[model samples]
Target chain A: MNTHRPWKLSVAGWAALLLFAPATVLAHQEIGQITGFASGFLHPISGFDHVLAMVAVGLWGAVLGSPAIWVLPVAFPVTMAFGGLMGLLGVPLPGIEIGIAASAIVLGIMVLAQLRPPLWAAAILVAFFAIFHGYAHGKELPEGASALLYSFGFVVATGLLHLVGILLGEAHRWAVGRQAVRAAGGGVALAGLFFLWQAVAA
Target chain B: MRRAVGTTLVALAAIVVASPAHAHLVETGFGAFYDGIAHFAVSLADMLIVIALALFAGLRGTRAARHAMFALPAAWLVGGALGALWPTASIWPVSTTLSLALTGALVALDAKLSDASVTAFVIVAGALYGFVNGATMTPGGAGGLALLGAVCAIFFVNTILAAEVTVLPVGWPRIAVRVAGSWIAATGMLMLGWLARPTLA
Candidate 1:
């Protein structure tokens, strides 16, 4: 896949960027950290494991129906927040990557198999997995990323990911759509297996 | 060839290791007034606290909403005046975030708060929050204009949000309000995480 650019071209590109770099220096880079909405929003959605798990949350909630529909959306973020808090405190919760990957596998199966647990039980299960995600993200949250807009974007993005799952779960309205939703679960499970393999291997 | 590789490697290394975050005074391209507005706008806890207060009031019905509309801005103004006069300890990142979480949780529950209770909550919260805001803006000490701008902004935002929530229909719209509250609640907790995180420096 001839993806590599010629060295000369790369060097020239570097030179061009370097030339404009001084302009950025004059644009208030020294005052303080500039907060980003896109980056925060992207953090959760950017990784495959996180996306699959978060979406699975919505899918499971939709399939479970009732209070969970709204409750799961709320629970995951708040629970994940505690997980993030734990990570910030450097409180060790081992197997973070494995747990995240496992969450996808388990949640995907919940949708694929249409498992229905009690509300409290489901919340606890989901909350347990949420800690893994929160810890991984919290540890990686970076130094200057501390601001409200960033947090807002991050939280909103998580809610949106759940929304995607719920919308897809709406397919359960019909038999064919139910099959489609189950197929999505199977697909998520498959992807999760790949991630699990990588985590274990790592 | 080696020179080019080294240069590329250096640039890549620079990009990878760069940390571009700190808390410092920034210009908002408008003036102190706009600076105040932007400051409030950019703040997560402050914005969440106001939204939670408004949503809590709105969910409690019109009387509560009305009281908050009047009480919040006025209390904030008075507190801001005192803050500008004498700066006090900053309780923002912690106290404000605590308020954000609690008030947000209240909104999410759509709790049936008494009108008097709602009014009292808004007044004390507003004054405390406004004092912190005013103290922060006093770095410029430009005749309290920025603080006034922030206060005006607080008033407009509170009124508009509370008004809209007050009029929401009974079903999905109300559910959406609750969802929004939960999001705010989650954001507050996450903000606390950020606050507690160690900086690179």
Candidate 2:
């Protein structure tokens, strides 16, 4: 039990750092011609809000147990693609940035509270947020880029982030680790609050 | 476990280490083959369905996986044939979305359907995928090569997924697969809503 303390602390500390780390501005255009697979893959991972929300979705799913472990992660990219399509077609969904920030806040709070809503409820929550995330991805797509390849890259990146969350969330299997996960959730929620403030303030 | 991990590592390495010339050049002959592969690789809707079907086959265990290995490609070929005969209309995006949703739900539920039922599902899935592929792809001089490439690519992906998942240690890893299934289903449902949403008048 004593030996496990370090492992637990490390996990929690990492989650805290990830959530609370000062935001870095990514120069998507400066990256230059994000036209191929590599660029698309990097896009989702590039944004701090996207990363937090995606990871939170995974962490929350892990905490929920059973089917959700897969469901939330899977729904995100699919719905995001839909949103991306909307963006591509020039369809309007207002306040996309607000929605993206709200996702982190809301999902982070869900984890922090250790809330386990019904499966359908959870799906709805994530799906609503996914559109914004996907739309943002679509909106950023380079002119004349291979839409398919770009989407593939971002989806893969998004999946990897969810995987990270699941791996972190799996810590809940241990009694001591459960609290650690909750603490991580608190960190995520705090990050979300900061993001929300920024969104609103802007 | 080591073997599965090794296979994945090898595949990733192959992708990373491959020459750029092997990827971007669109030419005749081999280029058409590459084009075919690229088409399937990037078609999100199709890829999702293939993945869902593979996941479903994996959840069903090895027997279903075996059946899927044969049935999916054969049905795809049949679908292609039908498409060649009357390549009139493409399948609706909604249909593909529905298929993905169904496959995901099946995996999430972990229902113990009969092998025949599973095979039928795979057949339908294959044919549907085939029909779409055939309708969209222009069968030029390299059409056969393109078809072969697409089939091979799909086969490779599905096989890896089904094989690795079939061997996963039960408990946490297995539960993770089911969770993935649920996500697929949720995505499908949301896509349906997106499709149905009324546009600004």
Candidate 3:
């Protein structure tokens, strides 16, 4: 395994950058203390469950390879904008909290299933779920933040995570690595299952 | 397993650190204004439809089946434009509920439609949602933006769930999907219950 590959280093470096970036630097101050971008970025990354689920999206995309690899990540942000609009229009989504938690469980399972859907199918599937993801982000956009910028920031971050998964997926060309990634997917699915149970019981 | 464990641990750590930031906005005794905006912004109809679509998609294993899914954003666009054009009252629960219910029912049937049929369905559905959103205006300064954010959050969350469904094997996937549907149904029921609760005399 060539650890010195530039592409690999670039991805690793980027992940490290995001991980080490100061919360204050990422924080948006547009609306009061919370800019829409800051809030959106924080919203997904803040919750442990959300963090796992989102990263899993990238991982699964990587496993599926190619088009799905790209489409799913793109689908989330584009549809999310639409969902945000619905939120703006006063269209409420019932069971938001539970829905949010379910996202983790559902996407996690998808990774474990390793279903390789076509590009178009992947787009549609991801888009459908994007509405839920977008609605959640729209609902929480702080009062004073700039909605456009907020949405943009989160979308960018989301894409990066997807890219991370793609890199990792590519690494799975090796048998040992593939098993490792699959195992990772299964683990994520299990965590989602736990969250689903907790949500249901509560 | 080690990698999974590591990822999970990191995720948990992140959540613990960010927990304090999840505080709800304080009400500041501005109930009349906030409540009005809240009602207008939280469309029960859209939420219901979204939940239904998510459930249907998860169960059927066909995300492309529901072309009416496009209606949601189209409605939002029209609603936003209307709000900009004519600012009025902050609440429109009746119109909201009706539009969402119609959309949900239509989308439920969408799985049966051809591509062209699905497109037509989405157009009609979007218009209805748009019309309802556009006609209703919140009295306060609050516009459709807030509601849009709320709904986006919900959709995003559901998307994550739908993705998970794809990962699960057929045998056990149904159980998870059913659980999700039940969760959505329960949430809808709870909201309805809250709405129908007897108002203070």
Using lDDT as the measure, which candidate wins?
A: 1
The DockQ-derived docking category for candidate 2 is incorrect
Q: Estimate each model's TM-score.
A: 0.81, 0.63, 0.42
Candidates' C-alpha lDDT? 0.81, 0.75, 0.53
Docking class of 1: acceptable
Off by over 4 Å in 3: A1-36, B1-201
Determine the backbone clash count of candidate 3.
56
How high a TM-score does candidate 2 get?
0.63
Clashing pairs in 1: A33-B22, A148-B44
Error of 3 at B98 (Å): 27
Candidate 2: residue A39 lDDT (0-100): 78
Q: Per-residue lDDT of B1-201 in model 3, one digit per residue for the tens? A: 445455556655654464333212433533434433444344434445555554554444445434334444555456555654655534444344443434333332334445554445445444444444544534434455644553354446446544554466754345434433332332232223223322310
Select the stronger candidate by DockQ from 1 and 3: 1
A10-33, model 1: which lDDT tens digit per residue?
Answer: 776876565444323333332323
Model 2 accuracy (lDDT, Cα):
0.75
Please give, for residues B47-159, the per-residue lDDT of candidate 1 as tens digits. Answer: 77888898899998888999999899888888877777776556566777877877888888888878999999899889888888777667555437777777778888999
Comparison by DockQ, 2 against 3, better one: 2
Candidates arranged by TM-score, highest first: 1, 2, 3
